[model samples]
Target: MPMKASGAADLTVVDRFDDGVGWIAYPDETMQRASHAVESDGQLWVIDPVDAEGVDDLFEEFAEVGGVVVLLDRHKRDAAAVANRHDVPVYVPEWMSGVEDDLDAPVKQMTDGVGDFAVDRLIDNPFWQEAVLFDGETLIVPEALGTVSYFCASGERVGIHPMLRALPPKKLRQYDTERLLVGHGEGLSEDVRQEVRGALSGARRKMIPLYLKNLRGALGI
Candidate 1:
C-alpha cells in the first residue's frame, strides 16, 4: 500500500455515530488507514489516529481531547502527533509493550481501562501484541478484525485479519458487538453481531482461498 501524508482536503468522515466519528486520513492508500475520535464522559479519545489538517475540527462538539490510544504495536500512526497537539498523553494498554518507547509524546500506561472502554488483550506474541477496546456498546478492534475489502471474504462485512484467519481469535466471539470500529477501512454499525460472528465462524474455512485471492491481488493478476 502506498503511504502518503494527507491534508484537510483529503479527510473523509465515516462511521459517524452517536458517540464518536471515524476519519480516513489516507483514503488513497490500499489500507484505507482509519482513525477514530470517541466521546466518553465529555472527553474525546482519539484511537490509532492519523494526523490530518482539520482533524481537530471534528472534535469540536465532542469536548476536549481526553487522550490518544494506540491499540496495536505497529499502529503508532501519528498518535504522538495528535496527542501532542491536544496536550494529552498517548494511552497504551498496560499489557502492550514496546509501543510507548516509540512515541515522542507523553505516554500513560492504561491498567484497567481508558475512559469507559475496557481493554481486552487479543494477541500477545513477541511479534504482534494487540488489544481491543470494548465498552459493552462499542467494540474498537485495531487489527484482529476489519471492514476493508482485503480483510473481508466474498460476502463478509467484517473479516479476520489475513494473518490471523487460520486460527482466528476466538475471544472476540464472546462479545455481542453493537458497533465495530477498526483501524482499517470504516466501522460497522448495522448487523454487527451477525457480521462479526460470520467472519469468525467462516475464517478458517475461507483462509486458503482468501490467501490465494490476496496473493493474486498483490501480483495484479
Candidate 2:
C-alpha cells in the first residue's frame, strides 16, 4: 500500500499523561494515524512521527527533540524529515537495517534497548512486523496492536488490530502496563494490561478471517 501523506496542519493532541507523555493524531483519509512524544532526561523523543508544518512550534512547547525512533520499518513515516529539522539522529530497530536508504538524517541501530526503554518484538511476520516498547510502566505498541476495532464483539472499541490477528501472541502479561500507547489509534489509560490480553485472546480464534481481510486491505482490493 502507498504511504499516506500527513496533514500536519490537521494534527491535534489527542491524549496527554501526567509525566509529559502525549499522543498526537493526524487525519489520513477516513481514519487517523498517530504518533507519540515523551519527555525523558530533559529532552523529548518522538516515535513514528508524521510530517507537520507546525512541528517546530509543537516541539518548542515540549523540550528540544533529542532523537526520533522508528519501531516498524514501514513506519519511518516522517521520521527523517522531522529529524533533519531538529538535527537529531533517527534510531531504527536492528531488524530494519536496509529499509532506510532514502532517509535524510543519520540513522542508528537500536539493539536490545535504548535509554531506559526495552524493545520487544511482538510479531514474527515479515510483512506485518512490529515491536512493543516497555518503559517500565507503559507499553507502547506499533501497528501490531491497536484498540480501534471492536472485533472481539466487546461493544467497546478496544481489540487486536486486524492486520496483526494472524500472528501469534507474545507473552506480554508480565508487564505492569498502566498506559497503552498505540501507533494508529487512541491510547488507553485504564485496564491496559487486561485489554491487551483480551486482544491477544481474541486474535487466536479470529485469525483466519482477519488475515484475509488484512491481506485484501494491503493489496487495496
Candidate 3:
C-alpha cells in the first residue's frame, strides 16, 4: 500500500522503494508532478522540490534534509526554497550555470556526476537535458520519461511524456531497473523494464506530430 502524508493535502507517497527511498506527488490541475528523497547514512537528500507550502512539515516526517539536487535546468522549481529552509546545498548540472543566478542558497555544480549516487547523464538528446538517478534497484528519472496516470488497484501505467518523446533514445538499456520514479504522473513499481523498453522503442512514431508542432512554434510559422 502507498504511504500518506500527515497534514499535507496535496502530498502523497506515490512510490516507495525497498530501501526506504520514495517520491512524493504534488498534483495540480494540468499535471501531477513529483519530488524524490533518498535516505542514506541517516540523512535525506531531496531532488526537484514541489509545492513549498508544506515542505518543512514533510521533511519533519522524514529525516533531516542534507542536500538538494536539481536534475533539469528548467526544473529548479522549489529547490532553492527547500535548501534555504534546511540550510543545505543545491546541486545542479554544470551546463546550467545560469540557474545559480535564480537560486538563493549555496549552489554546487554536479560536474563529475553525483558521487556514489549512481546517477548517469542521458547524452544525445536534442530537445532538453536530464540525468537518471539510480537508488539501489530503483531508477529515478527527471524527465524525457514518466507516467501519465495514477496508481490504482489494477496497476500503474508508464510512458514517455509527450514533450520529451521528440528526442532520440538514450542509453537506458544498460540499467537493470526494478522500480521507476518519475517527475510526473504516477511512479511505476511493476513491470518496469518492459515499460521502459516500450517507451524507448515505440515512442518515435508518436513523436513525429509533436516534434513538427514544436518546430513550428520555434520558427513562429
- Which tens-of-lDDT digit does each residue in 1-221 have in candidate 2? 12444433466675577544544545543345678877666778888887765656666667778889888767888889889988999987777645468677898877775556788876645565667788888788877666543233344345666655666455666678888887867788888877777777777676666566656666778
Q: Per-residue alpha-carbon lDDT of model 1 for 1-221, expressed as tens digits?
A: 56444454388899898889999987878888889999987788999998887899989978789999999999998999999888999999888888988999999998877778988888999989998899989999999998887898888888999999888998988988889999988988888988898999999999988888888988989
Q: What range of 10 consecutive residues in model 1 has the weakest lDDT sum?
A: 1-10
Q: How would you order the candidates by lDDT, starting with the best? A: 1, 2, 3
Measured by TM-score, how close is model 3 to the native structure? 0.76
Quote the positional error of residue 75 for candidate 2 in Å: 0.3
Instruction: Please list the residue runs of candidate 1 whose C-alpha ends up more than 4 Å from where it truly belongs after superposition.
Output: 1-9
**How would you encode candidate 3's per-residue C-alpha lDDT over 111-133 as one tens digit per residue?**
65443466567742444667777
Q: Pick the candidate with the highest TM-score.
A: 1
**Better structure of 2 and 3 per lDDT:** 2
Candidate 2 contains a number of clashing pairs equal to 0
- Which residue pairs in candidate 1 collide? none
Candidate 3 segments exceeding 4 Å error: 1-9, 18-26, 112-115, 123-127, 149-156, 208-221
Model 3 gets an lDDT of 0.66
Return the TM-score for each candidate structure.
0.95, 0.82, 0.76
| Top lDDT prediction, candidate number | 1
lDDT of each: 0.89, 0.69, 0.66
Superposed by TM-score, candidate 3 places the C-alpha of residue 126 at a distance from the truth, in angstroms, of 8.0
